[model samples]
Target chain A: MKIQQATLHHLATTESTMDVARNLALQGCPHFTVVVADTQTGGRGRMDRTWHSDPGGLYMTLVLKPDMPAADGLKLTFLASLTLAQTVRRCCDIDAGVKWPNDILVKEKKLAGLLSEMQATGSRIDFVNIGIGINVNNDPARFEPGATSIKAATGATFSREGLLDEFLGALKTGLQNTSLPSVIQQWKTLAVSLGRPVTVVTPRETVTGIAEDVNESGALLVRMSDGDLREICYGDCFHR
Target chain B: MKIQQATLHHLATTESTMDVARNLALQGCPHFTVVVADTQTGGRGRMDRTWHSDPGGLYMTLVLKPDMPAADGLKLTFLASLTLAQTVRRCCDIDAGVKWPNDILVKEKKLAGLLSEMQATGSRIDFVNIGIGINVNNDPARFEPGATSIKAATGATFSREGLLDEFLGALKTGLQNTSLPSVIQQWKTLAVSLGRPVTVVTPRETVTGIAEDVNESGALLVRMSDGDLREICYGDCFHR
Candidate 1:
C-alpha cells in the first residue's frame, strides 16, 4: 500500500511517535499513514525500555489496518525487521541481519529496532501502530556500547528521507507477501540466530540452545545439545 | 506490587496512552507509573479503529516493567479487564462480566476495553504499556448502540478518582496472580461467553459455535454443532 500520508516533524521531535500516531489514528488517519520525526526526545523499545534516538536518526511510526487476527499481528514485526534489514543492505551495502523478534543488526551490532502496537475489538483487529527507530546518520558515539549506526558501520550516510522511503517501500512489498511461510523463509535467509549457540532468557528461567530456525508462526526453534528441539514462542535471546 | 509512583492526567486525555507511557518510560520514569486521562480526544480500540471516548470517561494507561516473557504480556490485558470488571461491580451493583480476549461488558453492552503494547529486547518483555478506557460517566445514549457506560447502566455518578483507585487496587491484586492456568479459572468465572451460542469472526472467515471454555494459555475452546471442538487462539466473537 502506498503511504496514504506522511507527516514529517522536522525539529519537533517528541519522545514517542506512537503518541503522535495514536492521536492521528484517532483523528481518522487512513491506513499506511506515517509520522516521522528527526529525533525522539523520548524514544522507547518494547517493555517500556528506553531507546536512544538522537538527532539525525530515523524515528517514525506507521499506522496500519491489517484485517487479521490479533495473534497474527506479531507477523508484521517480523516482516518489518526483514524489510529494514534488507533496506539497510540496499541503502548502505551493509550486511544487515535480523536478531530474532524485531532487532536489526549489522555484524553483531544493533542497527535498528521495531515495536508494534494494536487496537483490537474482540478478535477483530482495528488498527496497528508500528514504531521503528533506525540508527541512520547519527554519530556512533551517541549510541551505547552495543549500538551502531549505519554511518559508523559502513562509513556511509544517506538522507533520512531516502532511508525511510526505502524502508517504507520494502515494508509495503513485505506486507503484500502475506504468506507467513514465505516471509519466514525470507526471514531465515536474513536471520542471525540460526546455527549459533545462544541463551534464551525469560522471566521464569533461561534456556541455552543452538538456534535452529523459526516456524511459520515466527516461533523460534532451538536445538539443545541433547538433540531436543524446542519451539520457543517468546523470550530474549543472547549470543553466547 | 504497590504502585510506586503514579501520574494522573485528569482531563489530560490523549489519543493513545501507549504513546504517553512510552514517552514516560523513555524518560527514566519508574516502573508502575500510571497515566490517566479523563477523556481521550483521540481514543483508539483494537485494529486501528477509533474508540469513542467522550469527556467524563475513564481513559488511562499504566507503564510496567514486568520481568516476564513478551508472550505472557497478554495476561496483563486479561488481568486488567478483570480488574475493570470487578471495579465496576464494586462501584455499582451492575453485573459486569469479561468477554473473551479483552473486553469488559455489562450484559451484552461493552463497558470497558484493554490494549497492551510492549517493548522487548528479545523474548523477555522489557516494559509494557497497558491502556484501558472505561465508559464511566458518559451518557449511554452518546455511545454506539453496542456500547454502554457505568452511569448509564447503574444510574450512579462516579468520581473518576474513585474508579481509578478501585481499578488500580484490583489490578494490583490481579497481577499478583499471573499464572496462566490459575488466571484462566478466574477468567472463566467472570466470562460471559461460556456456553453461549456465538459467531467468531476472523479476517479470513467466520465460525459459529458454542463457547465452551478457555485453555491454560488463554485460547478459547468452541464446540461446534458438528461435534467437533475447535480451539480459537484469537478472533472476535459475537453472540448469535
Candidate 2:
C-alpha cells in the first residue's frame, strides 16, 4: 500500500527502533508507520546483537501490512537490502553492493544492514516491521573492524530525511514488484557475493565454498570444495 | 541456565502471550521467563495474523537466551516445536507429530504452532522470545475446518500448568543439548511429514511434493514431481 503520510523522530540516541516500533505496533498503529532515530543508544541488529549507532547515522524502522502470507516474509529482507544499496548509491556516488540476506557493503566494508519482524495470525500475515541501520555520516573508527560508513568511503554527508525518503520509496516499489524473476534480477545486480570465495558459518557447521548466484527463493548457491554445488537456505556468509 | 526459581503465569485466558512477554521482557525480566494462557482473545501466529485460542487451549511464550549468532535464531522455532510435541504427549498421552518449520499435528490436524522473535545487537543474538499456541482441551467446534484440539482427538482434558511445566522442561533439555545431530534426531522422531504427500505454500509460489525428511540444519527436504529433491528452507506446509 502507498504511504500517504509518515512521522519522523530524531532522537539524540535512544534505545532501539525495534523496541519503539514493537510498542507502537501493539498500541494499534496504522500501517506504513515509521520511526527514525538520529542515533540509537541501544541499536540492535538481527539475532539480538548490538549495533553501535554513532551520531549522524541513519536508524529507522517502518511498520507495514503487505497483506501477504507469513511464509513470504523473508523476501522483505532482500527488498530492504536492495533499497539500502540503491539509497547509498543515490546519496553518494560510490556503488554499494548487498552481502547476502541483508548486509549492504561498499567493497567488503559494511555500509548498512536490515532486520525484519512479522506478526502472523493463523495462516495469514498481519503486519511486517522492517528496521534498518545505515552508516551514513558516522565515523568509521567508531565501528568494528569490518564496518565502514558512507562518509568514510565517499567523503560525503547525506541528509538523513532525504536518504529515508529514497529508501522507503525504493522499498515500496520493491515490495510491489513481487515476481520472483524480477526480484532475483534486481538482487543480482546489487549482490556482492557472486563469484567470490565465502565461508558460511552456522551454529551447526561451516561450509566454505565459491559463492554462486542466489536463486529465485533467495537461497545462496555455493559451489563446495568437492565440486558439488550446495544451496545454503539460511546462514551467515563471511567473504574471504 | 536452569530455571529453578521462576514465576509462571498459568492463566485460564488472556489476550496474547507475545504481548504479555513483551511487557515483562521490557521490564528487565530475567531469562527463562514464561507466560502461559489457557485462551487468548487476540492470539497471533506469524505476521500478526490472528489465531483461534479458545478456553482450555495453550498459549505461551518463553523468554530465553541461547548465546548464539543472530542468524541461527530460526532454530528456536524447531526447538519449541519439539518441546510442544513432547509436552502434548506427556500431558495427554496422545501421539503428536511436528510439521516442518513450525506446526505440531495429531492425526492430520494441527495441534500447535510456534513464532519466534529475537533481540540482537548487531550480529549477536541477545535473547529470543518464542511464542507458542496449542489447542489443548478446547472443543472441536471452537477450531476452524483444519484445526484439532487435544480433547477432540484424545478425549482428555490436560492441566494447563502441567503442560506448561512439561514444555518448559523439554525446552531446557533441548537447549542444553546444543549438538545439532541430537536435536535433529529428536525433531525427526516427532516429525510426521516424512514420506508424505504435502503441499508447501510459499508467498511466491506453491510446490506439491512428497515430503522426504528434514536435513541436518532442520530444513525440510521435498522430492518434487520432476525427480528433483528440493530443500525448503522456510514456508507453511499442508498435508494433502
Candidate 3:
C-alpha cells in the first residue's frame, strides 16, 4: 500500500496508539494504516517496559498486514530500527545507531524504542501493530539516565510530523523489499551490538554471550563463554 | 506444572473456555492449567466459525508454557487434533481423524475442532491456550449437516470427565515431546487430507492443489496446480 494512502489519526491524548491501531486492524483496516497520539497514559515497550509518552515525544503505531509468516515478522523490527536511526540522522544531523533487538541510540544512549504485537491464525500473520516511540522534543534528563532525545542531544526542537514522514518513507521501501538478506545487511551496518559482550535474559534463565550477528529468522546469534553459538529469541539484552 | 494442579471450574454457561483460560494465564497461572465449561453462550472455531456448544458437548481450554520458538507452537494444533481423535476412538470406539490444520472428523464429518491462541515477545512463546471442543452427547441432527457427535454416531453415553482425562494425557505427551518431526508424523498418520485433491481459500483467492506432506514449520505444504509447492499458513481447506 502507498504511504500516502495510510490514514493518520491524530489524538491529543490516549492510552496507547498501539491499542488504537490494533482495534483498527481488528475492524479490518487496510495495510499501512497509521495512528498517532500526542500523549499516552499507558505507553509501553518490549518486555512490559514503561515508556514516558509526554507531549513532545512521538508515540505512533502502524498497522501492517504483511503476507508473510509470523516468524518473518521479526525482520520488521530491524527495518523499523534502521528507519528510526536514519530519520534521526537526517532530521537532527546526529550519528544514530541501533542496539540489538529494538532500541535506537545516539552515542551509546537510547533515543527511541519499538514494541510490536501480532495476531495470527495458524501460521499466517493476521496483522502486526508496530508501536514506535521517539523522544523528539522531550527532555530526557527528567526521564532517566542514559535516555536522550533528538532535542536533548542537539539542543534543538523537531517536528514530530516531519520525522514521522521520513520514517514512513524508509519503512515503505524496506517493507516492499522481500529480500531478507539485503535488509539484514543494512541493519548490520547500523547495529552497535555486534561483537560486544552482552547478557541476555529470558523468563527461565540468563546467558552471557558476545553479540555475534542476527540469524535469518531475526534471532540474535550469541557466542557464549563456552564457545557455543546460541540463538536467543526472546530476552532482554544488556551491554556489559 | 501438573495436570491435576489445574482446577477445573465447571460453569453452567460462559462465553468461551479460551477467554477464561486466557484470564487465568494472565493472572500468573502456572503451566498445564485448564478450564472447562459445561455450556458456552458464544462458542467459536478457527476463522470465526461458531461451534455448536450446547449442553453435553465438551468445551475446554488448557494453558501451556513451553520453552520453544513461537513457530513451534503450531505443532500444538496437530497435537490437539490428534488428541481429540484419540479420545473419540478410545471412548466411543469410532475411527476419528484430523482434517488439515485444525478439525477432527469422522467419515469426513467434523466431530470436534481445535483453536489455539498465543501470546509472545519476539520468538519466545509466553503461553499457549489450546481450546478444544468435542461433540460428545450433543445431538448434531439439528446443528449442521456436516457435524456429528459421539452419541449420534454411537448408541452410547460417555462421561465428559473420563474423555477429558484421556485427552489431557494425550495432550501432555504431545506437549512434552519437543520433537516436532515425531509429532508431525503422528498427525500425518491420523490426517485425512494428505495425498488428496483439495481446495484452499484465503481472504485473497482460492487455489487448487494436491495435498502433500506438512513441512517442518507445521504449515500445510500443498503442490499447487502450477507445479509449485506452496506452504499455506492460513486458510479454509475443502477436500475435493
Candidate 4:
C-alpha cells in the first residue's frame, strides 16, 4: 500500500476519476492506486454536485485500503487536506488553509475540494476512493465565484505533475507517521473555519453558531447563541 | 409522511426488500413508502452478511426522505430500533433491547436486525431506506444459532402482518416526535451494550473495551483497558 509502489493510471480525459478509481478498487486493484485525469466531464463533489474539472485542474482519485474501521474513513480526507496545505506552503510558498470537511482555501478562496467515497461491508471498509479536484493552472473563477488556482494565487505557472507528486509523497509520509489523534491536531492547525460565526445547512435543518472547534471524531462543535453546543457531522458551512 | 398514508407494496417474495425499496425510491416514490416481503432469497445485514429472512418473519424496508443532513442518518436507525423495542414490549409483552449499530435482542437472544442505506449528494440526503427483519412465527434458530422468534420466546404464534403494522405505526410516530437530541436519549435507554465489556470487530481492526455510552452523533463510546475513551462510529459488537 506504499505510494511509491502504487499503480498509476494516467488518462487524458475521463467522466470522473472517482468512477474510474472505484472500478479499479472493486476489480481488486492494489492499494494506494492513483488515477489522474487531465479533465473530467462528469466530475462531482459531495451531494452529486458537479465539479468543474477543466483541463488544467488536478483531477485525481486515490484508492486506499487502510487497516482501519469505516468510522475512521474521514481520517483519509483529513490527511489528504493536511498534506495538500503543507504541499502548497512548501512548494509555492503560499499559505493555504483547510475549511472543515474538505475544501482547501487560499486567502478565503477555494484552491481545492476533496470528495471521498468508500465501499464497506458493515463497519469494515473495503476501499476508500478519494477524489481530489485542485485548481492548478486552470481558471476556475470562470465557473465558481469563489475559486482560485495555484497560478492565479502566485502569478506563476507550476507543473501540475510536480504538485501531484509532492502531495502524494507527503500523503504517504503523513499516513505512515500520523495516527488519528495527530491527524486531527494537524488538521486543526491548518483549519480556517474555527472561531468564526458560521451557518451550516443540512438537508433537514440549519444551525447558526460560532464555530468553536471540531471534535476528535471530526464533528464540528458550534456554540449557539443560547450557549448550547451543536455538533454537526456533515453539511455546507458558510462563514458569516 | 404518515404511516397510514404510506404506499405499502407487499410482495410474496423478493431478493431483498432493500433492493426493491431503493429502486422505488430512485424511481421517485413518495416518503414513507414501504416494501414488505414474505421472504428474501438474498437477505443481508451489515457488512453484507446474510440474514435468514424465512417466511413468517416481518421483512420490510421503510423509505424515508427526512429533511435532515446525512450526518443525522443514524438517527433514523436509532429511532427504528427504539420504536421496534417498544412495539414488541407493547404487542407481545417481550422485553427487547437494542445493541449498538443495529441489533434487537430479547434476553440476550437476537430477535431482529436492522440495515439502513441512504442516497445523498453532498450533505443533503435524498432518501434513507431502513430494512428490518424480525422473526415472528418463523424458527430462525435453524439458520442462525443465536437467534430467537416471538413464537420461540413466547411459545405462541403471532401474526407477522400485525407485527409489521404495529412497528410501522410506532415508527411513524417516533419519526414525527423524536428529534436528534431526544432520539439519542431514548436509544440509550433501550441500549443493552452500554456498561458492558465488549469486543467490536471491524474489517481491519478489533477493539475490546467496556462500552460506556453512545454520543449525540450515535457513535459508541468505549473505555479501553488503558482508560482511554474511544468513539467508534460503526462496528460489530459482541458482548464479552
Per-residue alpha-carbon lDDT of model 3 for A133-195, expressed as tens digits?
A: 999898765878889889988989988877888788878877887755677788889888899
Candidate 4 per-residue lDDT over residues B21-44, each given as its tens digit: 978988989989999889899998
lDDT of each structure?
A: 0.76, 0.75, 0.82, 0.83
Per-residue lDDT of candidate 1, residues A89-113 (tens digit): 9879999999887889888988888
Q: Could you tell which candidate, 1 or 3, scores higher by lDDT?
A: 3
Runs in model 3 lying further than 4 Å from the true structure: A1-5, A179-182, B1-5, B179-181
Q: The CA-based lDDT of model 3 is what?
A: 0.82
DockQ of model 4, rounded to 2 decimals: 0.18
Segments in model 2 whose C-alpha atoms lie over 4 Å from true places: A1-5, B1-240
- Native-to-model Cα distance after best TM-score fit, residue A32 in candidate 3, in Å: 2.5
Best by DockQ: 3
Q: Give the best candidate by TM-score.
A: 3
- For each candidate, report its DockQ versus the true two-chain complex: 0.13, 0.08, 0.44, 0.18
lDDT of candidate 2 at residue A26, scale 0 to 100: 68
Could you tell me the interface RMSD of model 3?
2.0
> What tens digits encode model 2's per-residue C-alpha lDDT throughout B115-149?
87765433344567789888877864555777888
DockQ of candidate 2 compared with the true complex: 0.08
Q: Residue-wise lDDT of candidate 2 within A137-233, one digit each (tens)?
A: 8985565888898888987787777777777777777778866456767878988889999999765679999998898767788999899998776
RMSD of each: 7.8, 8.1, 2.9, 4.7
Question: What TM-score would you give candidate 3 relative to the actual structure?
Answer: 0.91
